[model samples]
Target: MQDHASPAIGISDLPAREEGYVDLRSYAAIGDGRTVALIAHDGSVDWYPMPNLDSPPVFARLLDSENGGCFELHPAQAHSATREYIPGTNVLQTTYQTGTGKVRVTDSLNTGKSGRLPWGEFARRIDGLEGTMELHWRVAPGTRLNRVSPWADSTRQCPLLRVGDVTLGVIGCAGEELNFSDRTVSGTITVEAGKHRLIALISTRHEPLPCPDPEHILDGIERTVSYWKSWSSELHYDGPWSGEVLRSALALKVLTHSHSGAIAAAATTSLPEDPSGGKNWDYRFAWIRDAAYTLHALIRFGEREEVHSAVSWLLRMIRKQGPDPEVFSTLAGELPHSEHEVDAPGWRGIGPVIEGNRVGGQLQLGVYGDLFDMIDLYLEGGNVIDQPTARLLADIADRTCDVWHQRDAGIWELTEARHYTSSKMGCWHALECAVRLAEAGQIEGEAARWQTERDRIKQWILQNCWSHERQSYVWYAGSNTLDASVLIHAMSGFDRSERMSTTIDAVQQELGDGPLIYRYTGMQREEGAFVACSFWMVAALAEVGRKAEAERLMAQLVPLANDVGLYAEMIHPEDNRFLGNLPQGLSHLALMTAALTLIEKY
Candidate 1:
């Protein structure tokens, strides 16, 4: 409620870190399935993708430090910080220790017990830990993907704004104002031990402010905490790394889209992995590969409802393509027709924060494998696949038979056309899962022909995709290049034999960095160690009966998570800074899969 545009200590006068940069892993993220909040270690919400997962960020200080608006709550002085989510929930508690005192900031995005929400609300509670400490606050609403700079106004009671049909109100609980702009606000406050303050950002597009009393906020906080505790209590993980597993479950829960059951790749888009490399890409959409892995994680954790919701979303997304096939869509289930850069400067010089994904139009053959496997998994659980969905599956499988030999954009969605062997193997995976599904009475398909097609695809891959000289599978048919994606075959049951174990070791030596691994060579410096590849390596290790190695590798990955137990698309092992989008669905889902695989096997 208190705004301090001017800091009492003038830290704002200091220039921000250079562009194309961030204090890597400085923030933890929390979400309510509808929207996500990024909380910095120093207790600032530097970025939030608002209204929807794919919407332009309204608060985007992470992208533009000086002009972009952010909400911060940290100790008055320079402080040391460590934070984590409450046991198994998305509520993050960050503790800051200053020369004078210590303080704790609990950050959460309010959600209902039924895994639903009245609307999206990001709430922060500040509790003094020792002597008095100073806290700062700022709110700057940005255009989605950091495009438009909307105006902000305070009318004594609330910070109100009108943009199109959207109406927003920012309310503070224990502070007063510093400065208010048509598009930004900042302030500072003092607090002592045993005292507390609260702040809430509420969105109301067509409705009244529904202004609740401060007492009501206190009540909401207690209720929300209790609900998350009860929900997480249902998890069944009991392993050597139960703590990491629980954290992964909580992160996956935060990424879940309550209304549609879709889980986004990450909360924000186009945050570069290598700040100096210009390797930025938007990750605010859903991928079928992530959905399949996320469902398994939810199921392993006994979150049947979330699993069901994710399945429904997957079905709806695929069903919308109407028995024909295309790449996946945004979490809202809309196709990404194209991509273009916004006019704004990149986050710390990471240029061209892209909007929309042209990859949606490319033939990502791997998607077919992910989809059929998800459907097979759902059926194996004794869940019924609807007739329409079954029909769609068969049609897609038939199409895979027709197109299995074609080149694709590849799993990384690279722009060039290449004979990506993993893409063809993905076709094999689809046909294999389809045959199994038909045998299990899940669909009506040409089971014999599909089986024959599956065998033929395998034969083709064995002859063309493998590199005899390297004694391992390569990225494509003719090249000796290695891709981390081939590790999935060993884990996906496409090949769990001795050859896979050798390939796994080869991948470790060739592409693995410490326990983290890359998808492939920079291939022109477009990527870092793809985080999901590392998880695939973890799962593959477990499947090949290398339990201890898998656990050790898994241990290495847990620390890579930011304080809130979230992961991006990739990581630089040397520096351990998260690259790509925050809380990426593939990364988190892969983490979940690796955890479950270790628990189930070891």
Candidate 2:
């Protein structure tokens, strides 16, 4: 309920780092839809990936502090600092106050006049407010990630630097004019009142380099801010927690690729879920389940263009690849064929820092349900599908009936495959939606067989998955394990009776850590609380006619996000530190679904 415009705590001495690495909680994300950069509270842009969100980093101090590259600017020694998003926008402003004066550093990824990023352009503008403030800045493109040394040529029109395959045009680089031996740039400046300076970086992958003048670079910063504000203004929800909802929408927007409309799971990858060591994952790839959830959320906010782009991209890739779609893909719809434990040390020395996701080949029965649910929502939103898409959905529905009984990785993507209760519910939900589509003549399929199979799934779950002693659905058929993922079925209209109502309380009692909920019963020891599970429970509670309880839980979970309202894939329950990849798309998507579910009832 606190205003995001108000600073969370007073501006104190800037955060200190441990072994050259700041806490994951200290990072906030800025992007131009394609590239996302993580700027820490200490004024360091630590994790920046050029070309796209899933690409290798240009500045990777987030992974390896010692040798990883970074774009940094801050007070030379000691300065107090506070940070916030420029209201209703992804542009970040950091205030630095030293003994002599105050200054603000505004950061953003520059977009074109058409309000889209055609290539990578990073703009950092410094403006002086009070007396003279001395600041230091650096541009070091580290080579540890891809194992290629950086090369620079000061002889070019602009200082040109190449890190791996990408070439960078460093404009307004403030270092000495003839300094190119070290392949890095560093400078110091004294800003008196009313003084301003600019540092812009333009990068290209395989194409010719871009030329951006100082005046246009400054103008690009304002233009990017304008684009973000205009995008946020189109959302039309004014219910309770609307401020937090809008921030979540903006965060999801940061994860949504403007060109392809495929939303990455998170901004950065290999941030450990278990801070002490293992369980690091590369979540930058676009998963079908996550994108489907994103589609559902954006539809609720009446987002048209993003929704259309995502739907088109998903179907095009699926049709091209076949009805049994691959689990995840690149932003450009390519199936990822490469994954590696890269050379860099991980955040806080968590080893085996990875680049691409390794779990894409796993069989997850829930994906069919996610796909159909998204298609159903898209149709209900008053859109028409082509004949090919309709036939594709029908083919997928037939395949779902064949594979629903197979033991596979559940929604949690755990290694031990089983007949997960939620997985069956997902299949059932998919078939049920297919039946409705067939009844409405949307998708051509065996409506009668789908209906029959849906009933069989319902009966099987009732007979084998229910636990008489616990009065709740089990995680799998034989075990009594509690899973928060089953709560998702409530919103899908799987169950709305006394059994589901009782199961909600039982899962909360077993999985809840106040407002935070573990993914399953025994997961508290392995990782932090899963962020999306808590929001899924809120929707389940509201769906089963427990409005007051849902509201109370919603109130608690809304403020649990970071100061700028971005969430990690998980949150440490004890210290509230971020765990897993940051600015997770599923967390924000779940937040929107929970809020819309609550608003629809009122």
Candidate 3:
């Protein structure tokens, strides 16, 4: 509700093509826990999914700029724009300056007085800051991503657009009636200095539509600001780049599903990881590895209630899936299909816009350690584990002893299963945590077997995966490639020896792109820099007693994030453009982990 003096991002050089699609870096996110809407710097609501973040979007201009629908608002005359998040909140304020005047538009998916609203609300407040300005706005609620035909009915006092069972209502076009053409709603309004206007979009899914006046939506906006400020004030962090850390916390909250306590991997899906197409996958579902990392970060932030719910939810889902669970699952505890291509054209004409993740079917042995480590951290924070959950975890540790030798997808979820050294280390970490749990009397398991296998894994990795020539552990057995994933084992307390310390330098020399790091050795030609790998390296450096180097690398990495402190899944090292999904949870989680590791250990 209150705009602060954050640095403004100028949008004078926005990308423009035949379809008028801008770069992914030209957007900022606003959410109300259940869903997020991406507003481009040019005043277009490009991507918004209704009811849930994983649901089919009514506005999908980010994927298909032509047929994909959008909610657009900008000045009628030629102008330039600047954007920023109102401090301490996810609300976005975009100021457009024209030849005659300047106008400010504030965007938010409003919440209730205390918590989330029963329905979905998208509010935009317009204020005339100087001179007289005329602005144009439009709302079209349909996308080519799904099979829905939107039709406008001006029969009621307010204009309504219906898409299948969903009803979208438009309000606030003072002194002028809305124009309904085809399936789109459009209008124009003029305002002088010292005057303001309010426009809101209220929607419903498979239910009757409710007609609310402008003042009701306005109240929701105020409540939303209050809720965000209250939630953010609880995050206890005062380390270096404290502002960046707080912004990452707020961005992580945008990806968290409030109802189920499941954190999504990212907000939008099928945004290309590279420019030439290929490697597009849906990130709407929750990966156990990502959720575990998120839980670790939240615990370090001194958040109790949400961490409890997330640990319970994750453990419950893992238990439901029985042994050797897959990599990810839907927020509602359902399994996503392996993979499928949607019907829409992707961003920048990139095809094969995927709907589900292929990793859902792959066997990632590394997840065992992620699960056990999550439980270990939870218990370390003075939380108690129930008997049944403890027993189930003990059973999982037993299975890890049996499956440690089997080749699988590893942490990257590759199609070709290999004996990845990181996978073996993950299993070793899981067994070590199990032994600790047994020693603490939290779980009843075969501590001796776990210890034997853990030792065997350490010896095996040194024998088969280590390279005497490079003086670092390879990606897999009998290979010369180095993987950034090996950096994660440092945080597991797996290695403080000369091998890990030397491997850190090897990875830095082979994969480092300025401040960013690639995922692996040979894969640098395919994608941009993996956003979380650098953070993992930072934690690894701190773990290996190179505290000064960790501090310096952390300083470089924190400034690489976008102006609003939200990072995508990848970033182009050369051009500094955002690639892949926006507001990636793993990237933010790793950031919190690195920052906290420095504060706690070094």
Cα-based lDDT for every prediction: 0.73, 0.86, 0.86
Candidates, ranked, TM-score: 3, 2, 1
Candidate 1 residue-wise lDDT, 1-602, digit = tens: 01111111212222334542356466578777677878665566777766776766666777766656566666657777666666556677767778887787778777654655676677777788899888777666656444454777666677665443455676664347567777666678677899987777777555666565665665666667777777777777666656666666677777777788877777776787765746677777777777777786676566677778889988888877864456667777878758887766667756777777667678788888878877777777768878888888889888888888788888878888887988888889899988888887888878888998899999988888777677788888888888888888876787888778888888898888788887886532555688888988999999999888998898887777664556777787767767778777778778778878887885
- What's the CA RMSD of model 3 in angstroms? 2.0
Which of candidates 1 and 2 is the stronger one according to lDDT? Answer: 2
RMSD of model 2 against the true structure:
2.1
TM-score of 2: 0.96
Stretches > 4 Å off in candidate 3:
1-6, 144-146
TM-score of each: 0.91, 0.96, 0.97
Backbone clashes in model 2, listed as residue pairs: none
Write one digit per residue (lDDT tens) for candidate 3, span 191-243.
Answer: 78899887778888998777778888887777888788877777788777677
The C-alpha RMSD in Å for every predicted model, in order, reads 5.1, 2.1, 2.0
